[model samples]
Target: MDLLRDVLKGQSAKVFFSVFMALIFANPALASGLASGTSELTAFKDWVWTLTGIFVFLFIIVQAVRAMMDQITWLEFALSIVKVVVVGGCITVVTWAMGVFGVAP
Candidate 1:
């Protein structure tokens, strides 16, 4: 019974080591095969713009509630507009670049 348990444990360890090595070898190959240039940069830019838009929208809503509409500062309004424009512009640019480069999946 003890020998059987040891054999089972050794088999499990071997299987685990095989899986770990396979993942280690596969990761670099996958990363190297991906698009690296403008595609990657544009993806990062779009994510930043999306997060900024969400933050600005939430801030505007909170400020509008905290202060009366007339008392709200122009800076806040300008920031909100800028966030919207940035997000929209990023989406447009990424879409155009993807089409122009034929980078679709």
Candidate 2:
């Protein structure tokens, strides 16, 4: 009975210390840096660049797929070109918008 009591008390002390440390170390302000308009804008811009690269890579892969399809017609090639152009234009527009909005660090 005494050993069981000691084990339970040790577990209770660990729980209490963990909770106390969590409260002591917690930072509520940075929980969502976007909410505070902090450094997360830099993170957002990095993500935008990463996504832009991914889209361009995917676009090239799609163009390659289109080229490999033996029965692909001129209209299909034209549509692929149009798709790439539209995506490029959209990326440019977003970058411009971000610049105008002062999303930079």
How big is the positional error of residue 55 in model 2, measured in Å on the Cα after superposition?
3.1
Summed over model 2, clashes come to 0
- TM-score to true structure, per model: 0.36, 0.43
For model 1, the stretches where C-alpha displacement exceeds 4 angstroms are 1-57, 66-72
Per-residue error (Å), model 1, residue 89: 1.5
lDDT of 2 by residue, 1-105 (tens): 854676587776766777677774585644545655466656787898899789877876776677678557657767877887897798789978989999842
Residue pairs that clash (backbone atoms under 3 angstroms), model 1:
none
Judged by TM-score, which candidate is best?
2
Which pairs of residues collide in model 2? Answer: none
What is the C-alpha lDDT profile of model 1 across 1-105, one tens digit per residue? 854676587776766777788886677643454465446667888898789778877876876664555666767766766876787788789989998999962
Candidate number achieving the greatest lDDT relative to the actual structure? 2
Clashes of 1: 0
